[model samples]
Target: MYRLYYAPGAASLVVHWLLIEMGQPHALQRVDMDARQQKSAEYLALNPNGTVPTLIADGRPLYEAAALVLYLADRHAEAGLAPAVGDPQRGEYCQWLLNLANTVQSPMRLWWYPQDLHGLPEDAVREAARRRVEAAWERLDAHLAARGPYLLGERVSAVDFYLVMLMRWTRKMPRPGDAWPHLGALAGRMKARPSFAALYEREGLSEWR
Candidate 1:
């Protein structure tokens, strides 16, 4: 059986949703990040990075949400969450998944914790990070506008999960909806999925709506 260590609201949600989509039997261990449970020796041994959403399968631990989601999808190809190796859309699928991590995800992190990225006080750096986030959101909005539904057309690939969680982070920012209509719509669609609804219910997250 696979074991998934997760913190509520963390990138681990991507893995959790994927596992549920795949219909995999897994144990979910909630690591309390606020309590520093992730930094404990046992958790660190599983993942030295001490990050949630770590997967332990076959006695091996896998970190990083994107990697875990892709691994689960590939392992259970019958679930149809991942494109086959030779499929034409495979390239686009991989590209957008990684792009979400490298481009959209990174900028959101900067906005969330500006002091960590800029090595300055939040008071001194928040505005600069917010401006960068706004510019990034504008670019994301335009891209989504051109693409229509889903990052890669109609199929709900792993990229959607990443974007769903990332966009949720944006809702707390000033005027997030006003700045990015496409992203807001995408988030709404993601939340509408039964899988996401089940996850929210299981996680006891009343704020998902």
Candidate 2:
């Protein structure tokens, strides 16, 4: 069994969702971000970065949300959330996952906590981050329009789960991700899954549902 250290609605949400999706046996330890429990020495021992989602798998601790998603998908290969290693679509799978991590998810930190970009005006940081995120939404929407109901086209995979989670983050943005027609449709399709309902219930998340 795995032990997942998480904070409700944080980046850890994706990891927790994946565990639930894959029907993996796991337990959760909620890190109180508001109380700075994640920064406590004890939590730091498991994750130096003090991030939510320090997953204990096979008696070893692992972190990084995207990595956990990929790892879990690979571990539960029978679930078919990822393309097989030699499948033609495998390259695209890796590409979109990394793109989401690098292009979209990285800038999200600035949008949420602009002060972290020290020495820059918070407003300026937020504005730039917002544009970057919106541009990603536009690009993804076009891709969906041209070739998808899912990111990889015909099949739903781990990437869709990851994208849906990120899309939910944009729900309150000035120009939300779902404001794009194709993106809105994709969001609707993903959120309709029973696993999503289970995820929201488990995380105690009511918004963007």
Candidate 3:
């Protein structure tokens, strides 16, 4: 069984939701981020970065939510969350996944913790990050409007899970991701999945429900 170390409604939400959706056998160890448990020496050993969503797979520690998403989808190819390696859509899959990770998710970190900039004006940093995130949402919404019901066309993929998790993060933002029509439709479909309810219950999340 996989052992997942997570913080409720954090980046770990995607990993937890995937586990539930894929019907993977897993156990959870909720890292109390409010109490700084993720930074403790014990947790640090499992993930030097001291982040939640540290997963134990085959007795080896794994971190990074995107990498974990890719890993799980790859290992369980029958779940069909990822395009097959030789498929033409594979490149696009990796592209959007990396885009979500690099462009969207990274800026969101600044939006949530602008204090990470240290010496800079937190407000300026946050506004810049917010703009970057909104640009990403605009681009994605257009992509969906033109070519989607799902990011990968007709079928749901692992990236949809990643996307919805990020969308939920924006629920409290000045302009939420779901404010975009196509994005709102996508989020509705994803949230309707049975796994999401379990994810919310386990993570104790009520917002954006």
TM-scores of the candidates are 0.90, 0.98, 0.99
In candidate 3, what are the lDDT values of residues 90-201, reduced to their tens digit?
Answer: 9999998999999899999999999999999999999999999999999999999999999999989999999999998888889999999999999999999999999999
Candidate that scores best on lDDT: 3
Candidate 3: worst 10 consecutive residues by lDDT? 199-208
Descending-TM-score candidate ranking:
3, 2, 1
lDDT of 1 by residue, 1-209 (tens): 88999887788988888777667888999999989999999999999988877999998999988787778878888988778899998998888778778766676776677768555777556676667667767877788899867777777777778778777766777867334788778888888788887788777777647
The local distance difference test score of each candidate is 0.79, 0.90, 0.94
Task: Give the runs in model 2 whose Cα sits over 4 Å from its true position.
Answer: none
Model 3 Cα shift for residue 169 (angstroms): 0.8
Between prediction 1 and prediction 3, the one with superior TM-score is 3
RMSD after CA superposition, every candidate: 2.0, 0.8, 0.7
Clash pairs detected, candidate 3 = none
Give the deviation of candidate 3 from the true structure as CA RMSD.
0.7
Weakest ten-residue segment in model 1 by summed lDDT? 170-179
lDDT (Cα) of model 3? 0.94
Full ranking by lDDT: 3, 2, 1
User: Model 3 off-target regions past 4 Å?
Assistant: none
